[model samples]
Target: MTSIEPEQSSELVLRLKSGDVLAYEIIYNVFVKELLATAYKKTGDRVLAEELVQNIFISIWEKRESLVIINLRAYLFGSLKLSVINHIRSLVIENKYKEYKQVSFQEDYQDTSNLVDLQDLSGLIEEGLNSLPTKTQEVFRLSRYGNQSTKDISSKLKISEKAVEYHITRSLKRLKQYLKKFYIFLYL
Candidate 1:
């Protein structure tokens, strides 16, 4: 077997503590996909995975100054694992509560009520759009919110139809990925 770089984690951590935003971004860029994949595998929810990873990165950035991590990779993965477990546990609890509400409502001759609220979904969608890259976000808004056709979007933005389509598709795919986490919200 090949020898590993033992001090690599510490060196990265040192970079982080010295207020290197790029170092922090490098860390996030390196681990975000794996962290999200792990969360999705455990919970089978893409939206939750994305949201959880976003929060993880935000937390990491916020606490970077005080962080005392020996192994950055291990620390990040461990945090991700714990977050996934907590997310699943919360989902279980929410499901149980929903079931109980359904049963009780049925007994009282009431219909099933939506657990998620649409306003929340609208807010989340807006947030997701704003989080997208500028060009991607603009194309998405023109197509989705402005109700512009792909051809219209292309003409208006002075881009090719294919480029408009590509941006819209990518934006929708990302939105759908995050929305899947709040599938219950869609019902509302």
Candidate 2:
């Protein structure tokens, strides 16, 4: 493990907290390789690992003013660990949802009554989706229905990954609010 002396790490942290772009660049250059290696070891996917490291640096930059770091390397590694875990959790949930959708679709196909209810629910959800901005709706559909990764969506949409995330997050919040009344039991 690479360890920085306390004094140097403290100085770097102070620079980062002050929103120094040069300090941010220096810190990124210093830690990016190690962070990428760590993420790759955890994920075993080069592209995903790269994206994870990039997102971590972007997060650090965006949240610079609120960042409090006693040890910059430790903080960066901790953030990487959390990001990997969250990514894994999201994959698991997405897989489960995909399975549920497949099974439900099969069941609905065999039963006219269930198919009617599903059609109705699908219509309501479509209406809610349509209420979002065009970009947000497109992003949400690409993620949820097309089963595209954020990186893929960003590339296809010619938007940043952060923008993709932002759109999906906003779309979900709006959809939840709009559908909560009718789907209260389903949500609970």
Candidate 3:
């Protein structure tokens, strides 16, 4: 596409705005090469560059009547620059999302695996709890599983607060001893 005078350019713009297919074709042929080159050089991806330039042409044709292009060359280049920036930003965000998913999935897998060990330790704790007296077992379950405070347990069971504390402490000590060989002892 050879250079056109200002008058010829404006005339082409008018024809394009009036839905002249030939005028649109002339504009595309003239600038597509330069626009494609700029997009490729800036983005360093030939496929993406071609897609960006194609999108710009499609945009110009679709919005011809609404477009306020003072200089066609400048407008095309500006659109290409903005498209490149937006595409790169989207790629960066996509990569970050993938990384987050990968890390989170691994963490969740580890937690899921740990849950099985916790369940095993829970079973072992329950087994050791049987060795305690019935009253001691009742007090420990009320405080730990039933979410009752020592004072609440005392009021409910009609036992002294000190008695309730003694039972809970005894239950913990017994469970700790029972689980001493396991890593669950660290948490206790």
Considering every candidate listed, which one attains the maximal lDDT?
A: 3
The 0-to-1 C-alpha lDDT of every candidate, in the order given, reads: 0.81, 0.89, 0.90
Error of 2 at 41 (Å): 1.1
lDDT string for model 3 (57-150, tens) is 9999999999897887777889999999999999999999999999999999989879977887888889889999999999999999999999
lDDT accuracy of residue 103 in candidate 1: 86
- Cα shift from native, residue 161, model 2 (Å): 80
Task: Look at candidate 3 and give me any clashing residue pairs.
Answer: none
Q: Best by TM-score, which number?
A: 3
TM agreement with the true structure for every prediction: 0.51, 0.57, 0.66
lDDT of 1: 0.81
Compose the digit string of candidate 1's lDDT tens values, residues 111-175: 22332345657777887788889999999999878999999999999999999989998899888
| Root-mean-square deviation per candidate | 28.9, 28.3, 5.4
Candidate 1 TM-score, true structure as reference? 0.51
Q: Residue 54 in candidate 3 has what lDDT?
A: 97
Per-residue lDDT of model 2, residues 54-166, tens digit only? 99999999998898888788899999999999999999999999999999988777797667657867777898899999999999999999999999999999999999999
Cα lDDT for residue 102, model 1?
90
Ranking by TM-score: 3, 2, 1
The window of 10 residues in a row where model 3 has the poorest summed lDDT is 179-188
